[model samples]
Target: MCGIAAVLNLSLAPVPHLRPALGAMNRLLQHRGPDGEGTWVHPRGVAGFAHRRLSIIDLATGQQPMTDGRGNWITYNGEIYNYVELRAELGAQEFVTTSDTEVILRAYARWGADCLTHLRGMFAFALWDEDRQTLFCARDRFGIKPLYYTVVDRMLYVASEVKALLPFVPEVETDLEGFKDYLTFQFCLSGKTLFRGVGELPPGHVLLARNGGVETRRYWEVYYHPDFDHTAKYFEERIRALIQESVAVHQRSDVPVGAYVSGGLDSSIVAGLAAERQGPGFKGFTGKFSLDPAYDESAYARDLARSRGFELHEVDITADDFVGSIEKVIYHLDYPVAGPGSFPQFMVSQLASRHRKVLLGGQGGDEVFGGYARYLIAYFEQCIKAAIDGTMHSGNFIVTYESIIPNLGSLREYKPLLQEFWREGLFEDLDQRYFRLINRAGVLREEIKWEALGPYSPYATFQ
Candidate 1:
């Protein structure tokens, strides 16, 4: 949605490089926001903030380091979908711009950090309070967008992506433990990254930095506490309501919006709901690998588009595409953490950007609905481990997993995965076993011999 950078130093006078460093960080994030760029330095020359915007909402008047005409200033990314409602709740202020960034500033003034409780959309933002002389920063509930920061030489530097921090702290070197985690888990397992000094702002949390010290606190958190009292019919109605409501609100944009349809159940449902609300002539995009039937789903996408009466666009990617863009992809990603899926996804994103500025996808449906094939494999291995160790009767597993919930046709293609999971007595601990399941990549398994990985294992949680 946007890029944000800030430098705060309260305990010492500002250095000459601090303001220029903010500009360099903003340049590194040009991809995140190409619509506009702005930077502001505090009057005392001790603190500065910068913004790069994609111009999704209030395109004309929404620019940052937006100020309240008072001293408070903010540079924010991602949308606050409920701003229209929030604006009403705040009653009449001067109302200079129709931007949600203003809604955030007023809300903070009225409620302080309590404003986070009223927000509903994905976001990562920094707000500067001149009156209190404090710097406040936060990431959204799910960390959909990212916020990275580090403290060096008593000045705090924060940015939307990790690469931006490198300019200021170029002397910082590799993090061996983080590198080990990336090899085993395919991504940094904790806030610590491959770089030694930088760390991420954990999701649903806030940091307040002042006087050369910073304090971080959790503004929200995620927990699973299942309730069984509700009837099946009640849940069905709720799900239906949520689907319609979410699709309608997420389509809130001054610019054109499009959906990424893969023809899978999740993408199909998302596209179908959007088509119903958006009417005919809506646009959709999909990607396919012409080399293999296993990877090609654009045909199904065509069928859905015809049924929904929306315009359909498709892109075909070849091995050459992978070879050419792999370097750039890894550069933008900062780490090759994900699977080959990122390649095709990038092509599809490029295709969609030509038609619409805003694109939505069913990105997390697999994790949310237990749709990943790996989940079935993981559960089956757990059952086998339980049977051998006499924990089969421990009453720890649900009865539905006993028969492989949705029968997977042929596990022949999945054997390499199973071998990787079961080898090295990996199923011994539930946490370690679960880690293997998430990090399961047959390609990675085949490339890196298990013997070399003997000394390396994943930590259950970030220490």
Candidate 2:
């Protein structure tokens, strides 16, 4: 991964202090890409791009803010795992560099915005189309990479991190709506960020800026279409194959690759498969809390690493470490988003960074596979209700009481969450039930001024 920043004068006037501003943004993001740095200012000064390259691939030649010599230029971060295939499909002869960045520029030259559909990896990038005098920007399908932009006085500022844009803003202020969303879900929705006027580009979306006007559009989305006709074993096999394929592509890198293991199913499986593919000398990292045995899970990580024949590295995270790093964590994060776990994860990353530039983890496994304890807690309640109402076999019930009995034990540690979740809504509308399950605002209601946050329904948004 790398860092990218851009400044575009949407009014089509020569941008003021283009070099200094862009240079500042690049300097602010120096940690993202330490290997090299570059900047490009359009001849007319209407557009400027700055890049800090991590040099993960094509280490010698993959410089950025690169141009196609045909009036197109791109500054990109993140890998295009399938770029090798895309290169062949796009006629490799046309590409001069061995970097995915060049592949993207070439793809845009041939397909324009549709080029996003051909990509198969995490990325956030901006491409300047000299012919059309338009600045085109996009985030990957899942927003796996960061892209934030703000338009102030007909000038658009974009960067991988909010801090890069802070210098340009007249005053540092919180976005009330975004703060409310954070209070509710610990994350903002609809492209809102904690910074006033700044917007996070949502997953699978594109933005175009030209002539002082900007428009954004969704290019792709995920939709569920269950296939009842297929047998359970068939779907299971397909999922297994897909995970294998995904891991294979994700291992494409010029730098050393490693995995983060939590001793849980998701990370364990990811690390196990990665170890098998990487063979000997593959490394695994784990962060454990020294405060309590309940918080420590390094044993599981050790077991997995030993079984898989990979070296296990552990970081004993102490309370003092958390207190010491909290300010820096909040600064880099822009604003608090996730829970306290983010700090430990940050420490783990720092540990892994010493040995490897690329570390794969099962970050999305819980969301994608419903692995959260709350899922079981919610379903366990539903199972009881369905049994009592004699609707155990109804289509609305995904699992019968007997079928879900074995999973009830898993909810033992989540009793507090279950207690809070069931206190107000007992078998209510599914949406309302889920909203209660995830809502964090209740805990801070007394401290928060609801009126100041304005009127909005996080529940309705959830629905």
Provide backbone clash counts, one per model: 0, 0
Clash pairs detected, candidate 2: none
Candidate topping lDDT = 2
Relative to the unseen true structure, what is the C-alpha lDDT of residue 73 in candidate 1, on a scale of 0 to 100? 92
Give the Cα error of residue 220 in candidate 1, in Å: 2.2
Residue 13, model 2: Cα distance from true site in angstroms: 1.2
For candidate 1, give the lDDT. 0.82
Report how far off residue 137 is in candidate 1 (Å).
Answer: 0.8
What residue runs in model 2 are displaced by over 4 Å at the alpha carbon? Answer: 381-398
Give the TM-scores of the predictions, in the order they appear.
Answer: 0.89, 0.95
- How big is the positional error of residue 101 in model 2, measured in Å on the Cα after superposition? 0.9
Weakest 10 consecutive residues, lDDT, candidate 2?
394-403
Q: How far is candidate 2 from the true structure (C-alpha RMSD, Å)?
A: 1.9
